[model samples]
Target: MNKDLADIFGNLVNRIVSFAHLAFDGRIPEGGAPGETELRLAHDLEQRIKALHRHHTALEFRAGAATTRAIWDAANAYQQHTAPWTAIKSDPARAAVITRVGLNLVALCATLGWSIVPNLSERVLGAFGCNNAVPRWPTGPLLPLLNSGAGTPVARLGLPVEKISSEKVAHLTARFGA
Candidate 1:
């Protein structure tokens, strides 16, 4: 696999894992109303998570049939759990369960070679809502590099790169000779 592609996938996996943890921890109690600040935070997190997914898809990485099906199943489960957020707000415990489902989906993605780092889960914690919690996102020229025609895997993808299965890699190799 391209090192640049691998790095991008690893970073995205880290971000997804962190965001999933935050979403899980952001749940309120049953019959409890969330404040404006909480709502804003949730909204920001939601948008960020959506952006992550969009970027991942834009990479167009493909996996084996079973792995792809498993990923889709996990994603579908996460969506099913999170779809009725407003209705389930009255059931806060269920909200936690839903967030946990999201975490499971993220975890599955991370486990299935979507991440280059093998011990990333051990390093990345889901410590959201803590005073010391600070997201350690990449502080580099990722956006500009991706948008530019730099000939890197990310630039070639025309977006960010995500997990590339062996089959996909072979296909891309035959097609692009990269």
Candidate 2:
């Protein structure tokens, strides 16, 4: 689970960083430079995500519901902020980044038994394009740290996690209750 979390968090960070470049560096080419409000919102969202990533890394990639909620809130806020921008909404690349981030976040929340509003998830999934994409959950060896319930304290952010191999790949699936 530690390795899995690491991969998820890492990918999210990569996506946010890439989007930040596009939002702040004016690398959107035809999108033109974003206004101050958009830039400020993007910067704030990026910084929050980065801080979460750093804290998670220090905790060895083991985070709880609070961390997951924090991530969702930040990204969701950014999505809402940029929803009014026709340029951003029309751009496939930029829209894809936000959509992918939201999709993965929903998946992560499900895997960790975290709760998210159903309408919000549906709305986010519909952003830009409705490409029936499914979120890929982590599939790898079960880390002993997660199984043992032992973790190194890292500023009360989360527990420590490390990779440990077992017999086969343990696939964790999230089931929704009816």
Candidate 3:
């Protein structure tokens, strides 16, 4: 079960990262500007992202619930063992619960776009007793990131700047003497 959960979470994170990369670098496939194909692909991507978000949320909730159950079960077992003392410290069980919680937290952080520095720092710093500074989320949609030279994924994938018009092509040729 843990492995399955981890795999699903990992896949979700990968997809989100891919989507973010595509959005930032403007590698969205062209389809005659506002053509039907482009609209359809945009809709499909939106739906896929939403579905991924829901799945990630559900997994996080389930993992948290499971951790709570494990903790409770361990506590009950400890009480039974130390009857009159009313406390039975089960270090092993406690450790297991902590491990499960940690894994779930990591998955949650990775899947919800929280792994990105700007988003992560903005959302999680307060919980970790940090009050130094918060980064702002990107203002526009993710597409601009993919199009900009600064996009990490764009650089990694070696995606070229898309040529959308003859004038732009001519201008580039003139400027760069291609």
The CA lDDT of each predicted structure is 0.38, 0.38, 0.33
Per-residue CA lDDT of model 2 for 1-178, tens digit only, reads 2354444443443343345345534121222333454445445544554555555567734343346656555545655555423436567545434433333333333333222233323333333132233423333321211112111111111211233444223332223322
Model 2: residue 40 alpha-carbon error in angstroms: 1.5
What lDDT would candidate 2 get against the real structure?
0.38
The predicted structure with the larger lDDT, 2 or 3, is: 2
Q: List runs of model 2 lying over 4 Å from the truth.
A: 1-29, 60-65, 85-178
lDDT of 3: 0.33
Superposed Cα deviation of residue 69, candidate 3 (Å): 31
lDDT (10s digit) by residue, model 3, range 1-178? 2333333333333332343343334222221122242234334434444554455467765544344333323323322332311111344333222222222222233233332233433333332233445422233332332122221221121211122478986997899997
lDDT of model 3 at position 54: 56
**175, model 1: CA deviation in Å?**
14
Worst 10 residues of 2 by lDDT: 148-157
For candidate 1, write residues 24-80 as lDDT tens digits: 433221223333433343444344444555544676344332343344343544344
